[model samples]
Target: MSAMGILSYGLTLCFVLVTFYFLRRTFEEKKPLVFDGYYHPEFKPVADVFRQNLLNGKERGGSFAVFHKGQCVFNMWGGYADNEAVRPWDKSTLTMAFSASKGVAAVIVAKMVDLGYLDYKRPVADYWPEFGQKDKGNITVEMLLSHQAGLPLLDEYLHLRDIVDNPDKVERVLAAQGTVWPAGTDFGYHGVTYGLYVDTLVRKADPKGRDIARFFREEIAGPFELDTFINTPKSEYYRAARLYTQPMWEMLLETLMSTRYFPILGHYILFPDSLLVNVAKAVVEFTKDMSVFNNPDLREVPLTSATVTSTAEGLGKLYGILANGGTAENKVLLNAELVKKLATPLSQGTDSVIKQENSMFGPGTVIMKNPKGQLMFGHSGHGGQVGMADATNKVGFMYITNYISINGLGDDPRYLDLENALYKSLDNHESNIGNQNI
Candidate 1:
C-alpha cells in the first residue's frame, strides 16, 4: 500500500477503537441506586434530595449526615464502595476526605488553644524557635492557620517519607524556607505544606510531643467516639471505599468551561513564576499519582492537610460539637470563647492559588455562607467531600463520596444542592415550631 493510504488506515482504526470504547461505557448496565438510612421526618427534604441525586446517576457510593443540637438528626448511606459494585457502602464505610482533614486539624488546634497550650496571636517562633529563621519571626500562629504566612510551597521538594521518618529534617527544611510573598500582606492556599508545618507546630507546642494525628486521636476522636482519623489504623482498612476519578478528557473540558479555572489557566500560562504555578507544581510533586491515595500506606501516614479518612456520621458529629458551642454529651470539647475565635474571619480576599474571589478563612477553616446567608465554617476536600458547621442554626453537615468530581475550581453542584435542601428543611422545621408557638 502507499504511505498515504497506510496513514489514513491507521487513523481510521484508532478512531473506531476510541468510539467503541466510549459507546460501551455509556451503554453499560448500572445497578439500581439503592440507599438506606434514617432521617427525621422534619428533614425528609434532605433525604429526598439525596435519593434524587442517586437516581439521576449524579452520585456514586457516598454518605450524608447532619447533626442538629448535638444529635444525629439525619444520616444516610448507599451505593457501591467498589467500582465493580460488589461491596456496598454502609455505616462503616470510610473514604478519604482530602483537604477536609484541615478542618479537623483546626478543631484540634482550637482545643489546644482552649487548654492554654497555644495562643493564636503569639508568634509561631515562640513554639518552634527554628521557624523564626529567614525573617519569619513575626509570622503568628493565626497567620499560618489562615494561610497568610506566605509559606505555601517550599523551595525544596518534600517526600512523605521525609515527614514520617525524618520529621526533624522536614522541620528544618520548612524553617529555612523564605516566604513567597510579604508575610501577613497576602494569602495563598498552603496545599502540601499546611500539614507539614502544622504537624511540626503541634509537636513543639504540645508538652507530650504529640503530632496532630496523635493529638486528634487521643484528645478528639477518642473522647468524641468519632470514626474520623488523620492516621488511619490497619484494621479499618477493610472499610475504605475505592475512589473513582473522572477521565483526563472530562477534567480538561470542565477546566476550560469553568469561569474561575479558565482565568487561572491563563495566569499560569502568562506568568510562569506566579504563586498559582508554584503551588500547582508543589502539589503535583507530592501527589504524582492521584490513585496512590487508595493505598493503605498513604492513608496510614498522617497528612493532616489531606488523607483524612472518615464516614459522614463521623464528621457530622464532630462538627456538631462545634455547631453547638463546642460541647457534646455534657462535656466541653472547646470553650465558647475558643469557638468564637474559630468562627471569626482571620483573612478575607481572593485566594492567590485557587483564584477564588471573596474567600474568607478562619483559623484553619474556610468561612462560607449557606443558602439562607447564615455564616458557615469548615474545610472542603479536593473532590466533592465537605464538612461544615452552621453555628447560627446549630447544624453540622457532612457529605462524603468515593466518586471524585471533575469540577476542581468551584463548589461541586451535588454538594451545594444537598446543602440547600438541608437548609430548606431546617427553615421549614423552624417555621412549624414558630406556628405552633403562636
Candidate 2:
C-alpha cells in the first residue's frame, strides 16, 4: 500500500474509535438509580414507573409528585442534578420547568380575575391602552391569554437581555406590531412573547404596577408557601439542578423519525417564511444555548413563559389547590367560580405554529386529557417537565427533570409512563374503595 493510503486508513480507524467511545459513554449507566421520598402504598405502581425511568437511563435527575384531594400522596426524587453527577437531586432540588411556568402564570391570572382586578371578556385595550394599536383594539384579555391574538412571534428580533432590560421598548414593539393572522381568527404558541405581553398586561392591570414574576411571588407563591419561582432568588440558586439538553444531532434524528414531527419539520424546511420557521428562529435566536439556563444569572431573569424553577412537590401542591376547589389548606387561593372559568375551554383548533391538532386553550392554560381520558389543564415546558391539575379527580401531578429530552411539549415517554401509572393507581384505589363499601 502507498504511504498516503496507510495514513488515510489510520485516520478513518481513529475517527471510528472516537465515535464509538462517545456513543458508549452517552448510553452507559455509571451508577445505580437510587431514590428517596414518600409514596402511599396504594400508589406503588406510580413509584415503580419512576424508578424504571431512572434505571433505564431515561432520566438523569427527576422529581415526581402527585397531590390528591389537596394532599400529597406521592413524592419522589432521585439521581444526580448536575451533568457530572456531583450533586444529588433531593427534596429541595429545583429544576427549571420551562413552559410549565405558563400554568403557574395562568393561576396568577385566575387570582387576578378572582380579585376583580381584571375581566376576561373585557378588551385588553381597557387595561393597557397602548396594546390597542395595530388593529388589536378588539382583542380581549381572554384572547391574549388563550394565544388567539395572533402575536406569536414579533416582526423584529429580540434578545433575552432586550426583554429583561427594556420593558418600555419591548411593550412598544409588541403593541405596534400587527398580528401575523387576523386577530382572534387563529392561534399560535407565543413561546417567548407570551411572557413579554402577559407581563405588560399584568403591570398595566395591577394597581401597583407589578410584573408577572412579582405578582406570582407576592400573591401566589407567598400565600401558598410554594417553592416555585418565576424569578429564582440567589439564596435558592444552590438547590437548582443544572439542565442538560439533548444534543442537536440526536434531536434532529428523532425529529426525522417522528411521524408527527417529520411533516412539520419538512414544511418548515421547505418554506422558511412559514410561521413555524419564524417562531423557531425567534426562539433559537433568543435562547441560543439551552445550557445557558443552568446559569444562575439567566435563571434569575423573570420570564413567565419559561424559566420557572421548582421542585415537583412545590408545583404539585400549587396545582393541588386548583384541583381541590381552588383553596390551599382551607385558605381560598382562587374562588371556586373562577376556577370553573379557568377549566372551561376558550379556544380549540389546530395550533398554527406547533401544528398540534385539536389543541385546546383555556383562560391561560392548555386543556389536555390525562392518561385515563379525564379532562385536565396545564402547560408542558420545553424539554419534558410537566405540571397539571385534574379537577374531576382532584389530582395535581408534577414531574420535573434536569435531563432534557428531544420530545415535543409534554410528549416525553418517561413522563407518560408515570402519568399512566398514576391514573391507573387512582382507578385501582377507587375500585378498592367501592369494594369496601359493598
Candidate 3:
C-alpha cells in the first residue's frame, strides 16, 4: 500500500509536469518568419500557401527557390539563422544539407555508369573484393541504391565512437557483416551505410582516389560555381550559422554550452557521422565561434550523408542543368539517358528492419511515386533540405533548411499543415486535400 501510494504520487507529478510544459509552450511566440506569397502568372494559389507557411514560421530562415529552364525564377530566404533575432540570415548562409548530399554523390555513380566504368547489375565485390565478406558478395550496386542490400545499420553493437571514430576501419567491419535479410528483398534506409558505399566507390573510380566530397566539388560545385562542401576545411570555418531545434534559440549559447565544444557541438549531435559534426567541432574549438559551421566547408572528403550547402539560386541553377538533361552552360554533367536512369527506382522489396517499402527511389533521388501527375524527380535531405525538378513542365525548385522536424511523421496538425501547403501549392485546387501532403 505504501509503494502504491508512492507510485501514484510519482505518476501524478509526471503528468502535471508534462501538462505544465505543454501549456508553457502553447503560448510561446515562435513568430520568426511569416510567408510572402509570390505567384507565377499560371500558379497563383501558391501565393496564399507561401503566405501561410511564412506566418507559421516552422521553417526558420529557410529558402524557397524555383527554376525554369536552368534559370532562377524565384529565390528568397529571410529570418535569423541563429534566432537571436540579431544576425539576419541571408541567401549566402549555408547549412548542413543532410542526405541530400546523396543526390550529389549519386551524380558521380551516374557518371561512372555513363562512362561504363561501373555496372549497376554487377556485384559490388567486383570493384572492392574485400567487400565480399559474409554473404554480401552478390549484392549489386543497384541493390545498394534501392536500399535492398539487406544491411542497414552495421551489425556490430555500436555507439558514437563506432559510428564516428574511424571510417576506413568501419568500412572493413561493415563489408563483412552478414545480411540481415536476403538481398533485393527489402527497402531500408542505409543512413551511414550509404556514405560508406559511395565513398569507397568514388575513391575507386576517381583518378585522384578522392572522396565523394572532393569529386563533387570538381565535378559539380567548381564547374557550376555553387557554394558548399562535403569535406569542410579549417580555413573558412568561422563563417558558419548556428542551428537550433527549438525553444533554446533565445538563450545565450555560452551559458548553455559545454566547455569541451560548446555551441558548434549541437550540430554534431544532430547530424551524426557527418562532416558538419567534425568540422563544427574543429571550428568551435579553434575559433571558438559558432559561425565556422556556416561557411563553405568544401574539401576532399567523401560524404553521401551530409556536406551539401547552397543558396536557392544555386539549387535552381543546378536543377536547370538537370532539366536540360545534365548539361548546363555547355558543360555536360551526364547524359540525358543517364538522368532517366537516375529517375528510375531500382526494385525495392520488403524490409526486415525498417519494414517499409520504398515506393520511390532513383539512385539517390526520391521521385514522386506517382510522377504521372507531376513528372517530378529530385532528392530530399533530412532537416527539410529539398531539390526537385518537374520533368513534365521542366521546372525545378530547391528548399534549404538547417533543421529536421521531428513532429512531421504523422497526422499531427503541424505535419498536415506543412504537407498540405506543398500539395496545394502544387495542385492549385486540383488535388484532393486528403492526398495533398503525401
For every model shown, the clashing-pair count is 0, 1, 18
Please give the distance, in angstroms, between residue 35's alpha carbon in candidate 1 and its true position after superposition.
Answer: 0.9
**lDDT per residue (tens digit) for residues 276-375 in model 3:** 2332231122213323334333322335655555565566567657766777778887889888887776654433333334446777666653223545
RMSD of 1: 4.9
Evaluate model 2: give its TM-score. 0.91
Which tens-of-lDDT digit does each residue in 289-406 have in candidate 2? 5787776767778877787889999999988888998987678999888888778888888888888898988988988888767788888887888888899999998999888876
TM-scores of all predicted structures? 0.91, 0.91, 0.71
Off by over 4 Å in 1: 1-26, 280-285, 408-410, 436-438
Relative to the true structure, candidate 3 has a C-alpha RMSD (angstroms) of: 9.0
Angstrom error of the Cα, residue 408, model 3: value is 7.0
> How accurate locally, in lDDT, is each candidate?
0.84, 0.83, 0.58
Q: Model 2: residues >4 Å from true position, as ranges? A: 1-29, 280-287, 435-438
TM-score of 1: 0.91
Residue 355 in model 1: lDDT: 78
Q: For model 1, what is the alpha-carbon lDDT of residue 270? A: 98
Number of clashes in model 3?
18
Candidate 1 collision pairs: none
Cα distance off (Å), candidate 3, residue 420: 7.4
